[model samples]
Target: MRVALLSDCYLPRLGGIEVQVHDLARSLRQAGHEAVVVTATQGPDEPIDDVPVERLAIPLPGGVPVNPLAPPKVRRLLLDGGFDVAHVHMGVVSPFAMDSMRVALGVGIPTVATWHCVLAHAAPLVDAAGYVERWADRGAELTAVSQVAAAPLRRMSGGAPVSVLPNGIDVARWSPGPRPEASTGSLRVVTAMRLALRKRPLDLVKVVARARELAPGADLRLEILGEGPQRRRLEAWSARHGAQEWLSLPGRVTREELHRRYLASDVYVAPAELEAFGIAALEARASGLPVVGPRRSGITEFVADGRDGLLVDDDEQFAQALARLATDADLRDRLGAYARSTPVRQDWGEVVAQTVQAYGRARA
Candidate 1:
């Protein structure tokens, strides 16, 4: 099958959806399908993992970094791409993605629209937008990364079937490996996520600080990986809390380095409350790291409370969980073993197979 993966963001941009688009395209191609990525992110023509990418020139409105492109260009691309099916990854506020979906359906192509965001507070607005887009075309199939993300859309779709298709990670690439022991005599707590407002990176600093206070004589070190608009604020917060020596914000690192960090770390902390499908937490668990995150979010889909890992309610509980994991190596090791053994999701090949089934349904 020839597939066109459309998105508002792509490579060189560090985001969860961007990574998912790239990985999905690659997986599709590996499954003997011709896959191409269409994006409004302006960049030089590049091939990610042998998948061809077409980057269209689009203007950023109101000085915002989002790619809001002209609909005509998207229509022309859909018409000219010669793809058998179109898979559009929709963001919470993605004008480009919606435009692509409309154009793909306008061209009478089988289209699969996958929602990748959890619009917690703005869900009503998103549902309103969905209602507005209801006139476009109803033939296209709909999916979401999690039930939390699918709720508002399903409500707005007026009973249109919205399938839940969670994101997949390259478990083999991120598999467990021998990690060098930490030189610093401290419990290593690691989290790799875009330092955004929804992620609550600043709150992570407070959690780490409170954990240090609760665990007397226990050295708790936090290593935050990934970069975003909140980097400066998080840095300032780390300094303000007098955790500069213990907390290190190394920004984004290479994929290999990330896997190594996960293997070496004692605990993985996910502070994001609105994660549609905590891929980072899954990767950490695959790397044999015990996860500590909120129970209400999508991380609950994988991280089992009091079994594979510990799930908390608020920042206070999060801090206490961290402190307990930091002080007890036996508990950490046992939880880590359980985390590695827990069956979360299928591999990329199986995910691609499921996606192909969705495409077949869209075409039928």
Candidate 2:
């Protein structure tokens, strides 16, 4: 089947939902299904890609234009493009999202959607709440990344056919085989995310810094990955605090290198207060590392509390969890094993196949 995967973001930019959309599109194509992605991007579309791409323009805060939204032309293009299924990543459902839904209905094609990001933070309730409702009756099926995210998105969609299809980790590419183990006797903790206030990258740094204070000679190493709008502010803040020594800012990492870091690291910590789904945490777990995710938000749907990894509600508790995992090798090994089992049944082919089935049902 030919599928049109629509999104507000795509490759060249690094984001959880963006990664999942691109990966799913690639998997669909690999599975003998033709897939095209329509995304909002700055400047001209680049030529380095195996899949066909359509770029859209987005409005900015001031005179400067932002590439975070797809233009109306996206709907026209998708309509003209021959496709069997219209699978859209409604992470930040915008005017384009509504248009896409309308187009699918007009073209008499089955429409499916994935609830990726928490919409409440992205825009007003009118767009976040009612827009999905307008498209809910139109959608054949809607899926959320995690069950926790489903409630909010479902409520927004007026209780559409919402299912929880947790994102899976590419365990083979992210295993420790590619990267060399740390030769030294230090516990390394890595945090991967765009440095945004919602992600709270600085909070992770503070937690690690506090952990270092408690275990003065524990030899804790911190690796901070990814870049974002808050780069300058975060860098200066890191300098002010004692976190500068332990913290290594490597900017954005490629998928291959990211997996290597995951394999080489001793621990993966996600301090996101507003995480829609912790895909990075899954990758870390798949790499045989224990996770440190907060008990709140969508991550709680996975990162099993106490069994597979630590889930803390506060900084004090999170710091304690980090200290405990750092000191206990057996605990790390046991939890890592459990983490691997968490998504053992998930496969790209299986996910795409299920999606195809949903599209078929949507048509009926």
- Which candidate ranks first by lDDT, i.e. highest? 1
Model 1 clash pairs are: none
lDDT of 1 at 70: 59
The TM-score values for the models, in the order shown, are 0.91, 0.85
lDDT of 2: 0.71
State the weakest 10-residue window (summed lDDT) of model 2: 62-71
Tens digits of per-residue lDDT for model 2, 1-364: 8888877667766678667877887777777888887766443465324777776755555323234334447556766787778877766544555566666766667888777766555545644456567666765577777776676666666766688766655556655443444433357889788878878887787788888777675778889888887678778878887567788889988878887787777778989866778887766766766788778767676567877778888997888777766676677667766765555434576667777777777777
Question: Which one wins on TM-score?
Answer: 1
Once model 1 is optimally superposed onto the true structure by TM-score, how far is the C-alpha of residue 70 displaced, in angstroms? 3.0
Residue 257's lDDT in candidate 1: 87
Q: How does residue 13 of candidate 1 score in lDDT?
A: 71
Instruction: Provide the lDDT at 96 for model 2.
Output: 54
